[model samples]
Target: MTVVIETRDLGKTYRETVALADVTLSLEKDTIYGLLGRNGAGKSTLMSIITAQNFASTGEVRVFGEDPYENAAVLGRMCFVRESQKYPDDFKPGQAFAAARMFFPNWDQDLADDLVKAFLLPMNRRIKKLSRGQLSAVGVIIGLAARAEITFFDEPYLGLDAVARQIFYDRLLEDYAEHPRTIVLSSHLIDEVANLLEHVIVLDQGRVLIDASADDLRGRAVTVVGDASAVSGFTSGREVLHTESLGRVTSATVLGTIDAAERDRLTAAGLDIAPVSLQQLVVRLTQKEEVR
Candidate 1:
């Protein structure tokens, strides 16, 4: 796999606040990455630094194996759709599309037009006058239509309803299948975008917490449910993420995979096993006092 973007011990600070700390990771080409984290987890900070919109306080960032800051060749191959992307007061959705078409070498006007129609965006309305959902649509359209070699979508679904968000996801997958590129999606709605991620990079407290393939991360944890005593006995010596008890019944979520033999043992002990979803695992892992 080709590493399109690489960062080494990246650190960012503003006075006393540290936005990112000693973060290092690689983004492979043609893969969809889910940048999952809480509101202040440094997801946007990391993307901003990589895109050269913001500078790192310490460490290095390389795009296409070269510094991205002020590098037109590298910057031109990337697109950043920010949650609060700014636009000219007088510019309309159509004008924004036109501007993007000229700036991105791989811009697809047909796709942009289709997306405009799909989202029911008003072409001639001033951007400042558009609804929040409409504003989000404009960003989503440009990001997908640009088809940049590396695209960063930092919470691009803001203000979008469930149906509209689904539309964005569906169209993204369809276009991606035809024109493959690196996509980094930063979102608090982890489960909604979980299926679209080939790889997952989770940040917490301005540091890298988990970096792994989505498939591998999926099997990294499991939930066991049954009688409180049985579940507690089985979870002994394991890393338990969370546990809840209702009377004599208990459900315990724990880290680590269960082999066939373990499964049989759990069944024999009258315990029920359940698969943990990506969102559940992330929530548990990032919680301050959950792991035990």
Candidate 2:
């Protein structure tokens, strides 16, 4: 696959604090990528810089083999959907969608109209009169209907209900299958969106921690549970991520996958093996580890 987005030693600083640090990543064309991290972890900052909404203090960014900053040709191919997308206070939802149709070359009015009805968004109401969930729906609708070559959604489902969110996800996947464009989704709902992601990029503080395919990440860690003594014995020379003890029972998460030999040993010791949730695995990786 061709590379659509690339960054080298990307860094951003605000006053004396670092927003993003020494990050290098490449995004392949026509793939769904999940950019995940806790709030204030530089996910938004990176998205802003990549979309040319903000400047990078250091390093380089290239979209479609060209610099995005001040480059309308490259910028025209990208659509950024953010939680706080602003519109004129007097503008109605219908007006917003109409404006988006004009700006995005491949805009699909039928799709936009369908999403408006599906989300139950009030078209005639002023933008400021809509509830948070309704406002979020407007962003989601535009993001999907614009059909830009590269779309970046930065927590676009912030206040949407479960049903609305599911609709957004379903529409995104369906349109992606038909259009086949590069889509980068920055979200905090890790487990909910895990299945939609082909690749996962996790950030801790301001640095990139994990960047790998979902398949590789699924097998990157495993948990073992059994009697305290047996579990402790099994985990002794391994890289442990998390551990929990209750009475005489214990469960632990380790950094490596369980191979045939390891599995046989655990089975012989009457221990149980389970796959770790991507959310739990990431939480452990980015959080302060507890002492046993």
TM-score of each: 0.98, 0.97
Please write out the lDDT profile of model 1 over residues 1-292, one tens digit for every residue: 9999999999999999999999999999999999988888899999999999999999999999999999999999999999899999999999998999999999999999899899999987999999999999999999999999999999978779999999999999999999999999998898899999999999998999999999999899999999999998988999889999999999999999999998999999999999999999999999943342
Candidate 2: clashing pairs of residues:
none
Residue 149 of model 2, lDDT score: 94
Model 2: per-residue Cα lDDT at residue 105 = 97
Top of the candidates by lDDT: 1
| Model 2 agreement with the true structure over 137-218: per-residue lDDT tens digits | 9999999999999999999797899999999999899999899998999988988899999999998888998899999999
